[model samples]
Target: MAYDPNNIFAKILRGEVPSKKVHEDEHTLAFHDINPLTPSHILVIPKGPYVSFDDFSEKASDAEIAAFTRAIGKVARDHGLAGDGYRILANIGENAHQEVPHLHVHIFGGKRLGRMLPKE
Candidate 1:
């Protein structure tokens, strides 16, 4: 699906909505998840209008993609999860239950947050 210019993340980028920011650089933005699943749960996103991870990889410049990934690492370290480790997740398409059309990465840690999906 095409990127929705009016999606919530777009609004956050436009400053139309408020978010507790964690980190941001020229090509990316990181913020706290409003409905956080863990103490250090955060959301990372590219500044551009890419609908999913695949879309971001295909359309965004190499520099932008690098910056996005770097930002994620920095945020994890800033939250003190680098040593212990952290979880980064990106949900794409409907089967993954991606609620938002805009592309985003979820960084979760700071505790024993476990089992995103049930054991098979």
Candidate 2:
């Protein structure tokens, strides 16, 4: 399937839409998800738009990946999830329930999120 250029994440990346920013650098931006899955649910994304996880993993530089991982760690620690650990997720295509085309990392951890995800 073709990627949608007008996704909400694209707007957020363009600054046309507002987001609760948590961390940012030249290559990536981290922010709170408007519709959170948990108390500390956050989204970390690359500034450059990618159609899918495969595209991101294939084209992203080592530096960019490092920066993203570091940022995720920092955000988790800042949110007090270091001791308990947090879940970092990246949904792929529609089968994975990806609503936005842009590549994003979801950082979630707050209460005891059991082994399975919460019911929708």
Cα lDDT tens digits, model 2, 29-109, are 999989998989999988776777789778888887788778888899989999998898988888889878888889999
Candidate number of the best lDDT: 1
Error of 1 at 52 (Å): 0.9
The 0-to-1 C-alpha lDDT of every candidate, in the order given, reads 0.93, 0.85
Q: What TM-score, computed on C-alpha atoms, does each candidate reach?
A: 0.95, 0.88
Provide C-alpha RMSD values for all models, in order: 1.0, 2.4
The sequence of per-residue lDDT tens digits that candidate 1 reaches over residues 7-76 is: 9999999999999998989999999999988888999999999999888889999999999999999999
Q: What is the lDDT of residue 115 in candidate 2?
A: 74
